[model samples]
Target: MDWLTRANRRIHRTLHARPANGWKPDRFRKMALPPIAPPGWWKALLRLPRDHYVRLFTRHSSVHPPAVGRCIEVAAAMGQVLVTCDGVGVARHARSWASHQTITDPEHTAAAAAARKASAATKPASVEVTELEERSLETNDRIFDVIDDGLSTGEGLA
Candidate 1:
């Protein structure tokens, strides 16, 4: 602070032909203080109530009372999630425990249902592929023979 003050005093200003210290006394009183922050300014830094949730597509993902119990157990195991003995504080996808009624966002539910229906129309059924038995190096000989035949017949390039 002393070094800065001494430096400020030493440096001369070309406009007034004087050091910075000479201008400080005149300007100091007139300078306005910084604006104060509004009440609950710290709240912006924190996670809001709505933010703490594991969202799921209700159309694809179903949730009953039994699933809520499983969710609480999973949340407890995961650690950071807010979990009580009764239910999980996270995930808005589930039904209310008291009313036993599902409380999904209406807009989101409609959108998910539409998307699910669209995908189902286009998507193929589950495909099952059988594993092939390991063959000897001789299996590649057939491919090489075909390549050699093509080259010999001038069908390789032209």
Candidate 2:
């Protein structure tokens, strides 16, 4: 591909150039395998040959996996490795491979239940009898004042 020349060069320099072995057959074979593309480029390239890119650019473009595979091969040759989601370099959602067991303490559970029952049974001390008495007095005074003010006088006529 037209964009592949720089990548090919990088691959040759990183993988093929071995001063010690001078291009061994085994090394070449290993390098021939496809490499993982950079995450950004890979994701972007994956959108190609799809309507997303075509609609954005208002132009038709076709992409083949072979080109991407070649790029990956070149990257692999250059010792560029792909990191899995769990790898330190990769961003991943929080996950646990192993199941987790929640531990419950019998004594603590019993204590909590007992406390809840005790609170439920308690009537919050009934707002103190003195406070209730004061509120009742206030309400009676208001009623008496309303009666004296002639607002309740209309009831006699009715």
Candidate 3:
């Protein structure tokens, strides 16, 4: 501190031929005030589009049913909700640890099972490639080959 202060004083005195007082006008008085807000200040903020999902992540920790419920409540208050938790606790619990383990939600499990059942019942439509479509795909592949060849040869078609 002493060295720095001495060097600073020496530099100031050498440059300006005077000791540095390090004093200035009141910075508070020179500060500018923020501009006034327009009439509908929260219009943009409050405007919500339809069909949006609120994603909440519980990273690396398993949440019990009550905690999950609370999270869901908060998310629901915001909008459409989806709460996700990423944890190895379930696997660990399954392996051995049997004390103070609150890691299962029966209702959520049942809902997931039902969703799986419904999904399995609904079969996806099979897609068939037409002759013209196959030719177009081949043409696209050739275009990529041409692009790769041109780029490798430095012909500037990349």
Candidate 4:
């Protein structure tokens, strides 16, 4: 080794602080410290691209799969509860995919509508032109009363 390296080590050893001069050798020799294990790594690390479905994927399919980035909670004993991303009530579709291979949510309805949009123009339109006679409100007084009564009672007029 270089002279400077040797000289530094020698000086460092001389300058190093030592234990108490009256310390017992037997007690010092008997001193022992417990070993420490490494920290857990797998449970702490979420493998790559944190935004993906890896956080929600179960088996080979994803459950609910988020409707417009919203969380969907479905109970195995109950049914599916799907809401929009903004937490707005969109549509209620009963849990019917029991023992199925894929999950179908409200978002899929839009996709199905888009796929069927191409054929929307293929069907012929049905228009019925009718002539109606204008009548005064006095002619339907009984109907209005019935409707008001139904509304007051929280019941359908029909």
Candidate 5:
């Protein structure tokens, strides 16, 4: 594609300026296959066709051509992850590939971005404690206070 100009140049230089022994087909195969992309390469890969890469996920979003095929082999999670560089995750995104479209899970992206803001990291979101549990805790606190007072006062501890 448009981003492959450098790759094209390198390929041209290698192929056209052949060695005295001529080209080795195996070397050409090695050249055709890319080595690990240095971080952010996934973004460039996104510019290419989806058919060329296997989709993958990180903690915060979806991505293409997973760090390794095994990166996407997990059974849990889908549709979201972070963008990794050099096998270590660096940025978050909601993953989607739909023909020149950018897709993201808004809430997921928000949370991912919030991670950088540190202050936005909060305790696990509140969950509704059953009314019974709420009452039990308050009642237990008062009862313990009374028992504590009694023990201090040398009153009935039996």
Candidate 6:
């Protein structure tokens, strides 16, 4: 057998050895077969544009409003809990809640969409788009900001 097939069989054997709770023996037996890869056309479609998938998924989120609503509710609850536990007053609590809301609220969805559009527009037409190194850098920068914010607020960095 080829390496891929051997690896898949090994995985199947390992998974079947320790069946999960509520797992049916028949299902486990069926799962021993190698997973079928998507056809060439499907792979080609996926390879077309990464942003297409991102936009499609984000659009899907709008179609299912419950996800956004859940996010808002969770964020609000977290903010409220934080304020209550910390014993912060009304104004401070409101500010804290607003900050959390800014990150999760559907109202900021427009700004995020605009930012994505701006980024796509800024891409060099001549060059092929590779993995987003800029986003990785931005993520690292945000981590630094979180660290700095914590340090400044006397949250002792270890």
**Candidate 5 wrongly placed segments (more than 4 Å):** 1-70, 74-97, 119-158
Q: Return the candidate ranking by TM-score, descending.
A: 3, 1, 4, 2, 5, 6
**Over the stretch 1-158, how does candidate 5's per-residue lDDT look in tens digits?**
76555454453564674343344665666645468654433332332122212334322233332232333221222444444445564335544444444444455345545554674565667888765534666587576774554464556656
Model 4, span 1-158: residue lDDT tens: 58655554443455363333323654777846658754322121222221212222231122222243444332221343333333453334443444533444545445546546865868778989899999887567655664564464556665
lDDT of 3 by residue, 6-67 (tens): 76566474456334444343454576766974443111111111211122233121223323
| Candidate 3: residue 97 Cα off by (Å) | 14
User: Residue pairs in steric clash, candidate 5?
Assistant: 39-85, 60-81, 60-82, 61-80, 61-81, 61-82, 61-93, 62-81, 62-95
Cα-based TM-score, every candidate = 0.21, 0.20, 0.25, 0.21, 0.19, 0.18
lDDT tens digits, residues 1-158, model 6? 58655554443554654333325766667745459853322110111122211122122111112122121111123223211112221111221322213213353355557667887889667977688545666586576775554464565855
Candidate 2 accuracy as TM-score:
0.20
Q: Which lDDT tens digits does candidate 1 get at residues 45-85?
A: 12222222232222221222222323232121111222222
**Pairwise TM-score winner, candidates 2 and 4:** 4
In candidate 6, stretches whose alpha carbon ends up further than 4 angstroms from where it belongs are 1-104, 125-158
Task: Give the 10-residue window scoring lowest on summed lDDT in candidate 4.
Answer: 43-52
Q: Can you write out model 2's per-residue Cα lDDT over 16-130, one digit (the tens) per residue?
A: 6544454476677775445865443112212222211111123222222212222211101122222122222211122222234222334434554666688799887655545
Colliding pairs, model 4? none
Please identify model 2 stretches exceeding 4 Å from their true place. Answer: 1-101, 128-158
lDDT agreement of model 1 with the native: 0.41
Best by lDDT: 5
Cα lDDT over the full model 3: 0.37
Clashes of each: 0, 2, 0, 0, 9, 0
Q: What C-alpha lDDT values do all the predictions have?
A: 0.41, 0.35, 0.37, 0.41, 0.43, 0.34
